[model samples]
Target: MVLLRGFLVLVMFFLLGEALRVLADLPVSGGVLGMVMVTFTLMLRGRVSDELAEASRGLISVLVLLIAPGVVGVFFIVEQFYGQWTTVIVALIAGTLLSVLTTLWLMKKVSESAAGDGRHE
Candidate 1:
């Protein structure tokens, strides 16, 4: 019942986002917009409910299991990726590095600000 309620919250946000997309003719997808809305909601609320946290943890724990079929399917389409493998590899590596660096930089800045470092600004 707790998980159900949490899932319902997610669905509600998604539907809200979809409605806004259709009405406003926004460029972003419903899923992304939904995430943004939920993030703002959580920020305003300042704390996650126990049921939502539990549900989120449960979903994370089985995430790998959920993606297993897609990973397996990649092997079946290996030939399609052969010619473009170099491009794919480079893109993947660059994207990963960029994300890591960006995350580290943001964390540093946040920490500095939290520590009352005027230079952070």
Candidate 2:
């Protein structure tokens, strides 16, 4: 029930985004806009509900699978990327490193905050 509710919330946001995009004639995809909306809502709420957390956890576990199609599609565009392989490789490498560094920094900050909170108790 909790998982269902969480998924419902996500789907509702996506639908709302689709509506808004169609009405506003926005260039961004509905999914991306919906995600942004949900992110802002979550930020305003300050804390995640157990249902949403659980749903997110399940989704994370299968995230690679979810993106598999997009990854596979890249192979179909092999001809288009033939002349720009170097550029593509460099961008991918840089993006991966940046993501890793960002995650590392965030984790360190979070750990430090947790440690500080513990010391105050």
Candidate 3:
């Protein structure tokens, strides 16, 4: 019963995503939109059923395996990236550092705001 409910919820989201895709003519895929819709639903509902939780966990566990083929395909472009390894490494490092700094700054700002509101210890 739980699995059925979870499946129904997933199907509903997929349909909603497809509808959005059709109505808006967005370039994003239906599955990606479905995921976002699911996330929004979960956020609004707060708690999910055990079946849904289990289904999500099981799906996530195998998600990496599903993308393995795409990863393997990267081998075909190895030559194109080989000569640009230095550039790729530098871009990756810079992006990582920027993300980390941005996250830290945002966290500090949030904490300060909370403290100002007397919501902090």
Candidate 4:
């Protein structure tokens, strides 16, 4: 029964992503869309079953290892990156800074809302 529920959750996420892609014209891949859908669902529900939690952890653990082959293939383009290294470095730095700022801003907004609710009570 637990396994069945986990499977159903996965199917629901996949369907949600597909529906979003069709309805909203999102450019992301189905799996990425599915993952975002699942994350949002978990956040909205505020809880996850033990079986599903375990499955998600296992999947996350193996996710990076699964992408290693493609990462290694980047070595083949080492020569191409030599001249473009400066642009790449700048982009990476800028992107990281933007991501950090955005994350902090969101955290601040959520915290302020929570604090306001507490003050009201």
Q: Each model's TM-score, in the order given? A: 0.65, 0.63, 0.73, 0.59
- Candidate order by lDDT, decreasing, is 2, 1, 3, 4
Which portions of model 3 miss their true places by more than 4 Å? 1-5, 42-47, 119-121
Question: Candidate 1 on 1-121: residue-level lDDT in tens?
Answer: 9998987887788899999899999999997899899889899999989877777788779999999998999889889777998899999999999999999999999987888866566
| Tens digit per residue, CA lDDT, model 4, 2-114 | 65677677777888888888888988877789998788878999998887876666667788999999999888988977889889889999999999999999999999999
Candidate 3 on 56-86: residue-level lDDT in tens?
7777889999999999988798787778988
**Steric clash pairs (candidate 2):** none
Tell me the deviation in Å of residue 109 in model 2. Answer: 18
lDDT of 1 at 19: 91
Ranking of all predicted structures according to TM-score, beginning with the best and ending with the worst: 3, 1, 2, 4
Error of 4 at 82 (Å): 5.2
State which candidate has the highest TM-score: 3
Name the runs in model 2 displaced over 4 angstroms: 80-121
Q: Give the C-alpha miss distance for residue 25 in model 4, angstroms.
A: 1.3
